[model samples]
Target: MTLTHNRKPDESKTAVLAVNVGKPQALPGQKREVMSGIVKHPVSGPVFLSFTGMTGDAQADLEHHGGPDKAVCVYDYSRYAALEELMNRKLDWGACGENLTVEGCREDEVRIGDVYELGEATVQVSQPRQPCFKLGARYDYKELPVYFQDSGHTGFYFRVLQEGEVAPSAVFRRISTDPASLTILDANRIMHQGKQDSMGMRTLLAIPTLSDSWKQTLLKRLTKLESEQQG
Candidate 1:
C-alpha cells in the first residue's frame, strides 16, 4: 500500500488561550520524590520569550528537557477533555508542562520547520514532544507515558528564532511554511510505530528544522535497520 498523508491547514485565527510557566518543584513519583517542571500554572500577563524558553520556566532534567531546539513545548487546548475522559481525571492547562497552551494547532496541521509569529516573538516548529516517564510521574499515572507516545496526542515544541514578550492571548501567524510539509503527527507515527519504511524515515530526516535529538535517534534506528537488511 502506498502512504498518503492528509493534512489540514490551521486556518482558524485562534489566539493562544493561555501562557504557562513552571519552575522545578518536588513531584510525587512512584518510588521517589522527583524534581520536575511538569506542573505549570497559567500566566495572566505577558512573559518574556527567549531562546532558552519562557523567562520563569525551568526544567529539572536539563539534559533530556530544555535546550534551544526544544525551547517551548506547546500542547493542544482541545485535547484535555478527551484525555480526561480516558484517564478518568480532570486536567488543566500546563498539565503537560508546556509553555504555550493553544487551540487549533494540532499535530496534523503544524509542520516541521514552519515559522510562526507568536505575539512579538517568532518561533519555528522543531519537533514533536516525546513524552517520557516524567509525564506519567507528573500525573501519578504510570501508563500515561506509553499512552502519550502511542496516542499521538503528544504536543510539539518550538524554537524561538526571535525573542520578545509574549502574552497569553497572542495569536499565531504562519509567517513561513516549510516546503517539506512534514507534519508532527506523521513524525510521531513514524517514530513511535517504528514502521520499516525507509522512505517515510528519510522524509523526516531530510527536514533541517527537525530537532537534533530526533534526528540522531531516527538516524541511529535507520542505520541499524540498514545494517540488518544488508546482513
Candidate 2:
C-alpha cells in the first residue's frame, strides 16, 4: 500500500513533553532486579536514540521487551488524567515505563504503521504495548496492568527508523499512515478484550509494518480457533 502523508494544522500538532532514560536498578522485595525504567525524569537536553533503544535505557526481560522492533515506548500524557481517576491517585510522568511522554497522539488515533518525525530521529508505530506483571510490581497495584489494558490506554512502542538525537518539546509530525488503518486501540482490543473477529485478525496479520512478535501471537490464536472449529 502507498503511504499517505498529511500535514496537520499547527493547533493539532503533537510534540514531546518529556524524554526519559533509565538504567537497571534493584527494587525491594523482588528476587531479581527489574529495569522497569518507570521512574524516568525529564531531560534538559537532547538524548540519542538507536535501533535497540534510547541511550542509557535497558530492559530487564529482553525475551518480551526491548529490540529493534520495540525500541522506544511512548505514552500520551493526556491519558494520565483518566488513569489517575481510575486508580484514585496522582501518577508521575514515566510511571508506565515510557521513554517519551507525548501530547496530542492518543492510542486510538495512532495507526500501527504511522511514521513520525521526532526531533532528529524518525520512528514508526510498531504495535500496542502488551502490559505485563512488572507494571503491577512497580506500582504495587496488582491490577494496574489489567486496568491499563482494559482502558485501551496501553501506550504504544516505536521502532527507530533513523537514529538521531531527541529532546523534550520537539515537534512530532506524522509523515505517513498505513492504508490498512488498523489502530493500536483495535489491536489492543483483539489481544486483551477477546474480540474474536477472524477477518480483523487476518487484516492485522497482513500488516507488514506490525511487529513480527504480534503477528506470530495472533497467528497462533487464529490457528487454534480454526482447529477447534474443524474438530
Candidate 3:
C-alpha cells in the first residue's frame, strides 16, 4: 500500500525546516539552517540539518573516525503538523546519533528505506537507530532507548542526492516504499509466529539488506519445516 500527502502550497499550510547548529554549548538556532542533508525515522517525521566549520580532513575524520557514531544532529519540525514537543530541551533523548536537536513532529510515521525530497536533496531511508551508551551518557537517561522505541520515534540515514539549502517550513514528499515493508515490528511478528511463508514475511526477507539475525533464523526454520512437510 502507498500513502501520499497532497497539500496546497500556502505559507500557513506548508512547513519546511532544516537543522542548524546550536549556539556554543546551547540549543540550536531558530532559523533556516542551510541544508546539507536530513535524517529519517521509521515511524516519525524527518529531522533537517546543516553542517558547519569542519573541512576536508575534519569531515573525513568525522565520518570514518570514532566520533561518527556519537555525533548527534538536529532538525526543526516546528512547521510540520503533528510534532511540537521537541523544542528547546537540553537533552532530547530518543535516537542516539549526535546529529540534531529538534522539536514539533510525530517522528514515527516515516519508515526505514523510504525516500524523501527536501528542497533539492533526495535521500533514501536506511534503518531505525538502535540506541547506544552515548545517548544515555549525554542525557543521563538510561530509559532513552525504551522511550524512543515505545514512542516509535527513530531516524535513518539518507544518501545525499541533490545538495541544496533546506529550512523550516519545507515540505517533504515520500516518493517510494522501503522495498518490502519490512519493519522491525514485522520482523518481531515473523519471529514469534514462525510465519516465514506469509506474503508480507516473504517480501521482507527477500531484501538482501534485511537478511540479518531474524531473517537467518526464519530461513533456517523455514527450510527445516519445508523438508518435514514434504516428508
Report the error of model 1 at residue 184, Å. Answer: 0.6
Ranking by lDDT: 1, 2, 3
lDDT of 1 by residue, 1-231 (tens): 222112222437555877999999988645777888888999999999999899899999999999999899999876776667667776676878889888778888889998989999999999999887888887777898788788888999999999999998886777888655688889999998956877789989998889999989989989989999999
Whole-model Cα lDDT of every candidate shown, in order: 0.84, 0.82, 0.39
Q: Worst 10-residue stretch by lDDT in candidate 3?
A: 50-59
Name the TM-score of candidate 2: 0.90
Give the runs in model 1 whose Cα sits over 4 Å from its true position.
1-11
List the candidate 3 regions with Cα displacement exceeding 4 Å.
1-108, 169-171, 178-180, 183-203, 208-231
1 or 3: which has the higher lDDT?
A: 1
Score candidate 1 by TM-score against the native.
0.92
Please report how far candidate 3 places residue 149 from its true position, in Å: 3.7
Better of 1 and 2 by lDDT: 1
